[model samples]
Target chain A: MDRGTRITFLAMVALLVAAPYVLYPVFLMKVLCFALFACAFNLLVGYVGLLSFGHAAFFGSAGYVTAYTVKMWGLPPELGILLGAVTGAALGLVIGWLAIRRQGIYFAMITLALSQIVFFYAVQAPWTGGEDGIQSVPRGHLFGVVDLQRPLGMYYTVLALFLAGFLLVYRIIHSPFGQVLKAIRENEPRTVSLGYETDRYKLLAFVLSAMLAGVAGGTKSLVFQLASLTDVQWQMSGEVVLMTLVGGLGTIFGPVVGAAVIVTMQNYLAEFGSWVTIIQGFIFVVCVLTFRRGIVGEIMGRFGPKGAAPTGGGH
Target chain B: MFELLGIPPQALFGQLLIGLINGAFYAMLSLGLAVIFGLLNIINFTHGAQYMMGAFVAYLSLTHLGLAYWWALLLAPIAVGLFGILLERTMLHRLYKLDHLYGLLLTFGLALIVEGFFRNQYGSSGLPYSIPAELRGGYNLGFMFLPTYRAWVVVASVIVCFGTWFVIERTKLGAYLRAATENPTLVQAFGVNVPRMVTLTYGFGVALAAFAGVMAAPIYQVSPLMGANLIIVVFAVVVIGGMGSILGAIVTGFGLGVIEGLTKVFYPEASNTVIFVIMAIVLTIKPAGLFGRAT
Candidate 1:
């Protein structure tokens, strides 16, 4: 809402609008999907003070839903994506309900376990095609109007979706409900004493986060025209966490930057095979040990919000 | 000729025994995890990698050091435990003052690095580690056949689990450890070296995982990816048992293993997920876990 921050966000948007012409469309779309995923993840970890380690369950499952609907049922891309988002929210409800029973570290562990359960289901479920995943998923017509097979057509759709998601998150962050959520994050017991049901607020935030991540995953399946077990795996969950952490835990623009940095790194390092895992681990160690503030968070510390902490401000 | 639920006794017992063996490793690994968490106040995420290290060390000892099964039983845990000490003193020691979750994140990174390096050198295919000559072959209990090595795993794990319980629940050293876990500063004021105790607790916990890994090498293929899959299940077990109580971990580990084995008989598809389903129910009914004290 600050003038400087608004201007910065506008400039970033302007750049994104123009980037498809300069860069590869597929790569940019990939970045957009991940940026959105990281943003959804940050909504919980950064704002709600809940570290969920199994977000890929939502993201990956969304991809599967979209892919299955579009490919098997011949649904249009828009419908498929919507179904995916709904699936993510529903899965989120079940998972968030279970996960919110615990706080802090236990919350993370529960989500991870629940996600593992989902992963096992994905592996064994016939519809998911197991390891091969749902492949060659037709891009389908965009609501039976726009042909998404055209790279530019898909790029614009993704851009429009990304901006909508970005603005929705912005609105949520500034809303009164968001303020209540922040209070719960800062002090749940005190928030409850203030006549607020902290658990409901936390659950709502978790669902919203899962829904948006589902959107990203569903969109990603469209872009790539496939959905696979790789999307549902624990490592995918870890990658999203890393993206959010590296960019900035609580900042609005942090996840976007973090996702871009990570996706770019993966693209270039695709040649190195397992070195990717080692390098990611190295970054995690360095980030945890030396710079928990992260790239966006550190900058925000010096120049942006005064009391805003990257994670929940605590001892 | 006897059958129950359309499955022969031999088939059911075979699956149950296999489950018991798997549960043995789970019990040992989770016991180590509970010990470390109780003292260090951080979950050891690198445990899977440490378990993998145990098997790798065993393989290396046989091929390079010219040592055999018995020696690996003695040496691998020591070697891996020392490595755990080095890790604790160097990297993990610094994070004690921060949120314990940071310790989890740090160990996760460590797990990735350890698994990655092994993958680079060994590749993904599991290497063969034959059962020791003395333990080779089987015992016919008339109704069913039991592999001796598998039987040894179950017995050894039970004894080890019991030995750990006796030490912590009965002895003076364990009393000190419990005291330090409750109030390290007060224990330190009482002239105990709480810092040293913390370090050793972590090492011992890690050593327990490595020991289980050594035991697992012959039964399961010695592969880099082996620990990664098993560790997640152990984590689920830890969660179900609640991290606070040692006995909860052991009981849940073995019991879940049996339940999972029986699921394999009735509904093979659900076996991998049955423990998780039970975990979900446990969380709903008793979020503090079977033995964990409610906060």
Candidate 2:
């Protein structure tokens, strides 16, 4: 990472650690979960150039699985989360395999159509608890030692997972596989002619992205102690898209910043009621029309990639 | 008195009628989407919201201005289409050269804003739009009671769909539009104002949605949430129809609506999901969509 990106990431870690004390820990956890979710989504859209509009299928399904395992099966927290990730990977395998056959807009539509199917299943399926959703899920003991019932304990667990996922994304983006994925995004035909199996790379990235999203969803279920249709709805998928777009597509830490801004905005604007959606809509229009580079991207653009501005720059 | 596949004729015909009505809306909306996508290459996510807006505009005009249904029918679509034109000029025009997904996101946000504002102002509880006086009652046919309003909606949609198709496929104006879609720069070289053509095309597409919205206001409650859910179903229809040709969108829209209606009659549990299931099967069998040419 560049100097600016490094400092920014560290600062975020410090701020996230201290946030629960000053702010509501639950709210902090929610932001972290969403930030991670946006990052996972960005892995496909930003890096792979595949905009999957139905990501909520993975995110929501994982949430349900984790909730069910912890609440009904009484599984350990780690195992429940693991199951959630596996569930997401499995779903990603099916969806990504089918979606990769088409390019661009068709891929998006197919993912959306497939995700709707998942939503319908969740609605009718008994395990999801129908409209009520799975509720009162036990946070359980974190690794058999940490009492997750405590806010700080839960905060740390979520923080660790977020960092791990974030680092994994960073590593993947910089790796050779990541370069191939980027190549696919930039130009698929060229990548294929160069002997790269572009579809396989896209599929792998999609599955990995889904798995990470599942981690966020599963953790969210434990953190909020609930899983419902809200998590799996197209609205949630749209929110991730908004977060990623606002932060900057194809950037590593942009999603985290975007998530923070959006979550903060929603928190402050909670009293404003429905105006939040309107404001978000306005922001989207503005961003697409003018600020396509997003907050971090703009900062990086002006500073020549040095990450000079501590507050606005990448690092 | 006889049964076909153990289903009563009355029930089958009832579901079929309901299906046809749904198909009408689907055909109109998807037809609009296909047109916009063809020239603009942007999926109008706000199409649903615009449809909702059309209904609301009609409602507002009727309640506030003492306008009749006929007047609102003419005015609502024009009003919504004007907004669409303005949106294209101000916001959408900027993204014409960039990734199309940006347009989708921008429109999605717009949808949220429109829906949110409506929800806040009107609340989620849908208000009823009275059926027009001319099409108020149902005609008791031999097998089923056919409401005149519903019948009008289906017929009107079919007529509108065909009219659009004919305009695009037959007229000299349509030839220019098609040529523009294939190569806007080339069409511009031919002395046609392609950019202005694009703006007008978007307006026309959105107007179709507005027309459907006005039609739907009576059948479904005029509510903020109406378009959000309907758009997803329409998206499924668009996928099944393949977004290729105008006729395909119309046929798929109506066919899927009928299928959904049948599902409601036979297995209400699957009614809501049957369209999506069909989309999945289509993707598995012909990933390009039924009417869509392989890209």
User: Share of real interface contacts recovered by each model?
Assistant: 0.55, 0.68
DockQ of 1: 0.68
What tens digits encode model 1's per-residue C-alpha lDDT throughout B122-218? 9999999989999999999998999999999999999999999889989999999999889999999999998899999999999999999999999
DockQ for all models = 0.68, 0.55
Predicted structure 2, TM vs. truth: 0.96
Docking class of 2: medium
Which regions of candidate 1 fall more than 4 Å away from where they truly are? A308-314
lDDT per residue for candidate 2 within B59-98, as digits (tens), equals: 9988899887888789988999999999999888887777
TM-score of each: 0.98, 0.96
Q: Which segments of model 2 are wrong by more than 4 Å? A: A2-4, A306-315
Most DockQ-accurate candidate? 1
- Give the C-alpha miss distance for residue A64 in model 1, angstroms: 0.7
